[model samples]
Target: MTRGLSRRALLGGTVGGLALTTALTGPAATTATAATAATAATKTAGAGSRRGAVGPEPYVPVAVGAGGGPAGTDRVHVLKIGPDTAHTVLVLVPGMFGAAGDFRLLARDLVAAVPGVQVWAFDRREENLADRTGFATPDPAGYYLDGHYRSQDPTAAAYTAGWGLARTLDDLDTVVRMAACGGRRRVVLGGHSWGATTAMTYAAWDFDGRPGYRDLAALVVVDGGVRGAFKGTGQPVSDSPEQVRERLAAIDGGAVFDMTLSGVGLGSRAESTQIWYQLAGWYAHHDPAGRSVLQPRLPDALRPSSPLTNAGLLGTLVDVGFGWPNDISVHSGHLADADADGVRGWVDTGITPMSRVAAAYAGGPQPAVWEWYWPSRLSVDLDVADPYVDTDLARSLGLRLWHAEALDTPLYAFQTSYAKGTIVSGARDVVTNSRIPYGTYETDNGMTHLDPLFADTPHNTLTRTLAPFLTALR
Candidate 1:
């Protein structure tokens, strides 16, 4: 079952209900922050045990270093795979609020399919738990009271300010250099979702004519390297510094967009399942009134009834992260056992964040299942905080304002013609405006945003698609 949702439904609203009140409290809104986070959570409890959703092999940590902050306390982590004899390397970046584990399918397949070619993934300093409505401090354990993001140094540092796009690019540069091993290793930079944006930002950054990390290889954007500037609900926002500042300010203070409405953040597992069931009714059964099928009541004290409307769920589920590209949800065995089994499991529909909560409620909270997958905890501070309008990084990245001279590197992008999102359109604009040596601007048929990431077999669809293009890289 494949379905296409209207762009309006997909780009819901920016501020969630709880986020509004928190942003109103100003920067010193720590007290309100906790309540807001609690509200964002479908269920809650005391601290749970630390566990990994993915196993401890193939994906090995290559380097561990300190992340930049006032305290320099946050930890930076990088993982890699491929034979040492390999000359070419592909470095992948995860999307916003996405962890390194999400790329397990792509990384594993790349190593097996491509001979002597290495694949690497990094857990960005930005991939941290929200600290009182901001990033800079990582609270992976405290976020769910379970130590999921093990790379986070709990005692490392405290939040001083936002980690801007420049720092994020620097982190990517460091990872690239590490992967190169002090020598000029042929490297291709690619990213999924927001990571694609990060990769594009890295490619666009002016390296001052130095060829350390900026040597010619190729820029691979998988579904998200677009300069989605000034995209808002109801109307397109103007690309103005004042507008950007106001947007970031709202998020920094504490603005939460309803996940259901925003078509971004995920509700609890129960909520997700409710969302899935509702989607199944519409796409599977073709019900015109499928919008109100399976509305699940949640445990959040204030907004107990899930804000997830049938209209929003219908669109969000078709997205790569939230649901399968194909609208149908398969009964893929017991998904909750993945954490204990140490196996990568596909998160089927009907398993929302509340699934863990329900299990925890019935029994003790089971170990964090599906290490490979995590629900998005949309942070006003980290995820959508930076409205990239007229910022220095935005200019360097060729985001809002394109710089043709700055973008002289080779660029290749795979965008589905059915894409109603910013990535494809943005890529086209960037290619048109910049001096990017056009490589492959291929459009795939019937592939959803995540089809390139979550291909499940050894003969992976994504790796196979990129093989010919990557092989021809000079």
Candidate 2:
């Protein structure tokens, strides 16, 4: 258990912070309240209206940066949701291999539920390099199939050699400052998975002698936080300066920056696994009941024993009991139409529905829900900057986490069943070490790593918890 404002206190506006003192006042407060009430009313009425009033406008993508690196890879893209005039803003960062559109549904829900708040979902600089031509075509599946069969590899953008945490943090700081509006608005920074780790690291980051926490009102970490490499699967944590140097040297020596899904073999050919995942999502959304085009191509070891529909194929690729690596597993569910049909379908047993997952994957413009070119260098840098311990490796990599002990911002951490209890334990460590006056730690053992973002609204534990916290901050 952790100590903080109760949901009731938070929602009832009984909690106070420095934010309350700086909140909108007089006529400005009245206008904002009216706009929010109207927006809420529209949402409520739209629920029952057959015509279904259009929800908030589509997220507007805005590019921000000083234009650095190869072809300006330093530029970060933000999908802005809700009215810009809203005084309170929440900036969300996606996890490893995730993009701005990953938070599409969550951002809409938050904007609707919280008055005078907007969500800025950001795609890291690497997203600029993703190839969206296949997704943009009338025949996305066909387009992707052609590329897959040809074994097309993603471009090895060597400029990514410098795209480490330092560069990432710098890019994030640019966005944070833009959203903050020179201290006129309260900004809450949050992220999921690796993005969550980035959020905490950002709060503790040293920006030219100014501590990172001072720029924000609070923090939110969903299913991710600082931990040693020993505590997690996939990447190995660097324990020494030599190990860090070795990893950096590998990147400098033409190592690819993009990540591939584990357990799937595209034979000996070099192909883009990120594109394969996106193709799965495209088919799942557009032809759920249709026969899968990608399944027959998969190796026998990884393919389903029986023929499956596109949705079922996608479920097998991402669902938890299918033996796909945990890093890519998004839900827990079984196959359907097993006995009565020519092709099997998917049945979601987890909090998130398959349809929602499909939309998250397939429904955005460029830089959709997937980050095709995730920098390996960022992972290496995070390993060296483990918040719980300081090592000589951190200095060698130019990583700084010196402010966790002095951080004063309130933190809210929510964990899923995926990481057992380690996620919440990490949050506890942050609060304890920093002596943070307010912090909340929650666990929903029923949900998977990605469920918090895709789970249905109203019943979503993340939205329910996060809305109240953001409200209290105001």
TM-score of each: 0.55, 0.81
Reference-based lDDT, each prediction: 0.42, 0.67
Give the lDDT of residue 18 in candidate 1: 31
- Candidate 1 residue 315 C-alpha distance from true site, Å: 16
What TM-score, to 2 decimals, does candidate 1 have? 0.55
lDDT of 1 by residue, 1-474 (tens): 112223344333222323332232223213222223223222221211121122233433333345445433364455665666678888877764345644654565566667767777776554333221211123211333232323323234223123455455556677787777766578888876657666766665554545322553778877655455213112232335565566555544533221222242333321232223322223212221122233342223212122232222232233233333222121111111112222111122321232222221121011110111122222221223233223673453333322334566666676542345455566767777666767466655445444455433432345666777777773
Lowest lDDT block of 10, candidate 2: 1-10
> What digit string (tens of lDDT, one per residue) describes model 2 on residues 1-474?
000112332222211211221231112212222223323323432352322122554444345554345565647788887888889989999987778877877887787789899889988877666657767676776765565323324344566677888888988998899899999988899998878888889988899999889999999988787764125333445546677677777787776463333214433322355567777888777766677878887655455556677776777666655543344556645565442444556665565666667666775546488776666688787666665444566766778777888889999999877567777888888888885788988888777667788776755899888899999988
Q: Best-fitting candidate, measured by TM-score?
A: 2
Off by over 4 Å in 2: 1-68, 148-156, 227-236, 256-263, 266-271, 338-341, 388-391
